[model samples]
Target: MTRCDWAENADEVMTHYHDYEWGVPTKDERETFELMTLEMMQAGLSWQTILNKRQNFKAAFADFKVDQVALFDDADVDRLMHDAGIIRNRLKIKDTVYNAQQLVKWHAAGKTMNAYLWAFVDGRPVVNRYQTASEVPAQTALSQQVSKALKKAGFKFMGPTIVQSWLEALGILDDHLAKCTVNHLGKK
Candidate 1:
């Protein structure tokens, strides 16, 4: 029952996320897009805050549907800016829409976000064995590569640090502590 130290004193929602969702590989396009947006929204903020407003984000952004969100205009930006339930950062809100548009373009080109992202790790998760949370890096070379590629693909709010966090959340980069029970789960 040993969990990551970070999740030890977290609320029920965060605990559930840590135990069930975090570092769990996902190939679902919509889910991947949602996590990407959440990571971007988490820039300069805490993950707890983003998790607290996840439902609000889902509602505001059409459940992270790429096509739907890609169509969001200035009106939608204004609406999101005024939404009290979610983080009201204008830049993040606008970037979410922009990223959605990029996702749509990728989809139209016969490439899913899931496929494009997983390809970086060669379709497998990179499991890291760390004894402490401090051993985990904030960003890595792989994340920098991915961030550059994403930016070239017209994605917004995808800097290396944010991309690294997104990759970890997506299970592409498994950074669970060695003592954590879920650490072993990342291995095939």
Candidate 2:
């Protein structure tokens, strides 16, 4: 089957991610938080690198449990910094904790990250019919709004470009190529 060019002839890990998870809408809280953190961690890095080290990240950050990560202190930060299995960016590590704290605060206020984010698209995915990678934009007006909202909500390391990629990764914005066999992802 013809897949998106990004995954065509790609590594096994990236191919699996594209075929199974990319552009697939999900409401699982842990998964959402995990992907958000992954996107944050992916700043200035290759997606392949992140995918390769996903398991390490999942283990290092308590399986991306927001509350568990929110409890991470300087000690955990130091440990993560020394971890060669994952990215050793101190600011990103600290920001992950801080972002989790923000998410916890929002949850306490009766708002979930899933609900807040899905609301942006009126609870539906926005499918795009781009024919080539070049047709896909790095950022959009909607992403700008989301990025600004996230920053105001005390989330760090999430700017428009990152948010755009995250949105696509979350399937809130389906940017599959027109001819991709998995363009309309549905749990496959």
Candidate 3:
């Protein structure tokens, strides 16, 4: 069966994610935050690696609840560091907590993380039709702008490359192959 460009292995988890989640536009705050967190965790790594550990990550990060994780203390960091199921990277784990707090801060500023992120795309998904993986961009001007804004908002581990990944995951950019169902170009 055909699938999105990123689902390389075609394993059960990857296939499920590709068909149901990948490139599907999501507006919920919690889901967006979780995808953002996982995308950051995916840095210098494979998506399948992160997908395999997503459950453990949800357990460790309290299901990506910004309210809950923003309150995480040193004890939380120490516990996550030793978790064998997840990536077990100290900096990445720490950034989850930091990013959660930053999300909270942005919330207080009358901005949803979704709102801040979707603003770059002007409140609509940037659909891209690529026949192959090589056609997709690793970074773009949009990602560069979002990366700078995220850093200014006190988020960590959110460079342009990471932001591009987030955009893809959040469906802010619909990077399905040209043949996928949602590939469309409106009157632009």
Candidate 4:
């Protein structure tokens, strides 16, 4: 079973992520928030590093529960800063809190992350048929639009590149390689 090029030579954790969870779509808000937070934390780091620390991130960030994370205050930020288990970047940690707050606001407005995001793609995932690893793009115009929209909505650490990765991680953009076996896994 050939995997996506990026995951083919990866470690066990990444291999598992690629094989099982990478592009599986979910409407569950907590899972969506978790994936988005992980992408935000991965800005300057490798995805493998983030994956290795995922459990720690979950623990530190209230298990990716947006409501719980939205309630994070200075004391919580300080605790996260001191936590060695997660990435511990002050800006990223703060942004995670801010993002949760924004999501909470969105929720109060009777909106959901899944509804807000999937709407951009007309309520369906965009399955790309790239032929090789090199053909995969880091960002797209749609990503830029989403980035701008998210920033306007008070989210931080969510530029186009990060947003694109988040979208892919959320299975909104199915980027599995055309020939990779997992390519069709998401379409189902």
User: What would the per-residue lDDT of candidate 2 be over residues 1-188, giving only the tens digit for each residue?
Assistant: 88888898899999989988888898888888999999999999999999999999999999999999999999999999999999999999999999999999988999898898999999999999899989999999999999999998889998999999999888899888988987444574
Q: For residues 1-188, what per-residue lDDT tens digits would candidate 4 score against the true structure?
A: 88999999989999888877777776789999999899988998999999999999989988999999999999999999999999888999999999999999989999999998999999888988799989888999989999999888888998999999988888888899887786445443
lDDT by residue (tens digit), candidate 3, 1-188: 55655564578898777777777778789998899889888988998899999999899889999999999999988988888989888898888888888888878888898887888888999988888888888999999999998888788999999999888878898888875653223311
* Rank order (by TM-score, best first): 2, 1, 4, 3
TM-score of each: 0.96, 0.97, 0.92, 0.95
Inter-residue clash pairs, candidate 4: none
Error of 3 at 163 (Å): 0.7
lDDT of each: 0.89, 0.92, 0.83, 0.89
Predicted structure 4: lDDT: 0.89
In model 4, the worst 10-residue window by lDDT is: 179-188
Instruction: Mark the regions of model 2 whose C-alpha exceeds 4 Å error after superposition.
Output: 183-185
The C-alpha stretches of model 3 lying farther than 4 A from their native spots are: 181-188
- Candidate 4 Cα misplacement greater than 4 A, ranges: 183-188
TM-score of 1: 0.96
